[model samples]
Target: MAQTVGDFLVERLYAWGVRKIFGYPGDGINDVFGALNRAGGKIEFIQARHEEMAAFMASAYAKFTGELGVCIATSGPGASHLVTGLYDARLDHMPVLAIAGQQARTALGGHYQQEVDLPSLFKDVAGAFVQQASAPAQVRHLVDRAVRIALGERRVTAIILPNDLQEEPYHEPGRKHGTLHSGIGYSRPKTVPYDADLHRAAEILNSGRKVAMLVGAGSLGATDAVIAVADKLGAGIAKALLGKAAVPDDLPYVTGSIGLLGTEPSYTMMMECDTLLMVGSGFPYSEFLPKEGQARGVQIDLAPDMLSLRYPMEANLVGDAAETLRALLPLIEQKTEKSWRADIEKNVADWWKTLEERAIQPAVPVNPQRVTWELSPRLPDGVILTSDSGSCANWYARDLRIRRGMMASLSGGLASMGAAVPYAIAAKFAHPDRPVIALVGDGAMQMNNMAELITVAKYWRQWPDKRWIVCVFNNEDLNQVTWEQRVMEGDPKFDASQQIPNVPYHRFAELIGLKGIYVDRPQAVGPAWEDALAADRPVVLEVKTDPEVPPLPPHITFQQAMNFSRTLIKGDPREGGVIRETARQVLGAILPGGRGD
Candidate 1:
């Protein structure tokens, strides 16, 4: 049998260690599908409901596996649909390669059906490397370079294959001038900073009486090192959302999450710390960090561009998080003082108690916080959790206590909606033996997640572990944006845009052959999760939650406090519920009799 360009492409990707490809088919790329059929399942092709979901799965696969994630799509709209997901990978520094079909060579400018300039479309997302193969022989180097570059740089890259060229016989580059050959394989180098830079960072860390450490996605493999360094410096560690699993929440001095959806301990520690050590995080909100020059800063990241980006670090050490921290550990002096650590631990303990009180507060149907709070201790060992971007993420950040073995992530840098389901799917694919769960807001579920539930129905039987579950917060409102309007814009909840139709998410899941459980009462939240975990198949656990319960910031500023009152004064459609929930949840703990802003 003669090898076609598509066959050769598949073989090359297999050589590059790609075992799975997520995509949706189209007429523009029929030849590649033919090749995939002929290859006898060397690479498992996951058919997504949409191209965007496929791209998101690829991005998430890369994040979970620490390997190259690849996705394919047809030309024109199919290829264009990959932009958002690719940008998710690009922004989060995940390695992903997008293979998109293009128009035939002869029909390039004729505007034929589905004829689009794919390289141009993918340029921004896969700007590091985006090339369209002109000849059958050119496909080799295109695949090699795209994979190598994406993996080495931890960035998105793309390769465009013309439909006509894909059907041609594969040929090697000629042994002559103007001809080139590319090889397979890439191994990440040992990136570490200079001894002098390490010492400088250590000096700054040692000099401060109160040190605070901020860890992000880059700190994943350096968990032990982060703990050791924090202990030696007597520093409190705070996790950026992406780094939620970098250090266990059970640690006495660990502040759960930072920024808008942060813990009060994290907010307080940042404000009082005399020095900051940032590790591999690109957390964009600078206001949540130490004010300008209040704290001496030191940052360590593999990419120099990310160094000193969020904060003006006095010592910018360019290196891998694990390696840099290990190198700097010996230079650091251990602090004998236990006062700072004691205070941080006490704050964290008290914050957890406050969270417990808030979770049990009554709501219209169910308190959203209680859902996650109840599920925390009940979570199975080695479970992987994902959450969509919205009010659900607020609970995901503040309510869930991620243990040492559990892995949790969501749309961190992009904060995109509709990613949780696909991310959970990818996580299941990456670790089929592990149980995976997704927490989504009703808005995101309506936007895209419901369709992907059909995707789960399609592939659930093959997974050895059938504990995959989607926990939907059916709040009947775009809860996060509604609160943002009231608190950030000082405007009432505009029902026209903020209100969403009440969706029977559990019924939809049951209709699609998955187990469904609905909980409208707070007391049922825990038992419903237990039932979902014990289901024979995939489950959709839907909880009717209150939308008016504000996703309060750790500590509200005076302006934000004013915005809260202004929105109420201007009149809100849910004014009664809003004021009641706000007073019961926020004012009681954040102001007056409670801690002042």
Candidate 2:
């Protein structure tokens, strides 16, 4: 019997190491889905509530597995909705393949039920795009090309399949697309090291009295080089939010993160440093930049384009970070005294002490930041923590620690919501032995496919520890959105009060066959958390939280502080006084009780 096109695509995907594919079925792609199901346990079909979630999950999977993660959508709105996740995959350099259904070949260009130009719609988001040209042979070639582009290029791939194409008879055997190759030919430019330039940079480091090293996401693979540079230069190391995992926080040279929402040590280091070394990071927040115009700085990156893009550079090294650092190692003269290093370490230690105290102080309607901090200490080493954008983003950015050997990934620049579940699913699938957990706000989780609980449950049936754990800090409202609203409109009344009602998220999980635990009491959080972790299956730990509590990122803008103050002072002192007092309790402990300008 001749194999069908549908059967061939499934075989190709299975060969590509895809254990599961997530999507919503439509009549146009029904034959393909049927073929996948008939493949019988080789490739599992995961049904998501929305195509967007499927895309997000697939993108996360690709990131975790370092292979092409595939998501299927049934054309039109389904394909359109996938744009968000595809954009994320592109920005983060994830490998994802979007297999979308199209109108029948005969109805091409006509406004059938779900017809749209796949190539045009996906132009910006996808690294490669193709349409199955109504021929089985073409479909076979395009699928192979897509897999190559997605995996090798490390970008999103979009393939549009018409109804007729999926049903077409196939003669040739399907072959898996080879991995896509990206950035291979772009050799690091050679650096003609000027002895004078090195001498000048070294002089700045020696003469500045105090210097700090700021690293960013682009420096991820060059840790040893960064540490050597920092040590040789007697520089304290600080990271942008995206670069937090580059160096272990416990290092004496480490001073935590810097940004609009940064920790105290980073803020202090950023302001106090007489000289700065910008390493492979494009930190977007210029507000956190040093005020001194004449402050000497050196920027080093493999990509020449990224250097000096954020700030002026005194010296630029356009080479791989490790190679550059190796070159500079011998040139750098070691410092004699440890006074500056000791001072920076002391400052960081003091700041952490204060933060720890603030995190533990008792209060009703628990502080979200405090809860997140406490939770972080309890997480097992190497646990993959995926955070959604919103207030939770602030918490995860500031508090979450990526222990050594742990893989931490987030939508740093293109930060978006609804990535938590997908990230956890992907993490679990990639590292079946490691624990994978997602921390999401109620609002962000709802936008993506929270229904992915089905996929997690299925995986859990195979392996229990790999069971995805979703810990939702459900505030019954979009607190992050409301906070932004308050900042923009200066009106607390303009909140997500209408969008969120008390939904029994835990009960909803139970109905789907996973363990569901709801924690309204702060005291119940620990036990519930432990139980959820020990559960033999996928679990949802829905934590009811205070919507009004803001994540304190230490370096909040002055305007934001004023708005917060106004919100507190304008309301009745009795109820609102509690919030004001809470704010004072946290912020007052820091410098001046004022905000970053």
Task: Choose the strongest candidate by TM-score.
Answer: 1
Position 227, candidate 2: lDDT = 88
Candidate 1 C-alpha lDDT tens digits along 1-597: 789999999999999999999999887787898999998999999999988999999999998899989899999999999888888899999999999998889999997988887877888899999999999888899989999999999999999888889999999999999878899989999999888888888889989999999999999899999999999999999999999999999999998999999999999999999999999999999999999999999999988899888889999988999998999999999999999999999999999998899889888889899999999998899999999999999999999988888988888899999999999999999999999999999999999989999999999999999999999999899999999998888899999999999878999999999999999999899889999999999999999998888897887776877777788788888989645655546755444344421
Instruction: For model 2, name the residue pairs that clash.
Output: 148-180, 152-180, 152-181, 153-180
Colliding pairs, model 1 = none
Worst 10 residues of 2 by lDDT: 179-188
Q: Name model 1 segments beyond 4 Å from true.
A: 588-597
The C-alpha lDDT values of all candidates are 0.91, 0.72
**Residue 113 lDDT in candidate 1:** 85
lDDT string for model 2 (170-193, tens) is 665345584222211122245535
TM-score of each: 0.98, 0.84
For candidate 1, what is the lDDT? 0.91
Candidate 2 TM-score over all chains jointly: 0.84
Q: Where's the lowest-lDDT run of ten residues in candidate 1?
A: 588-597
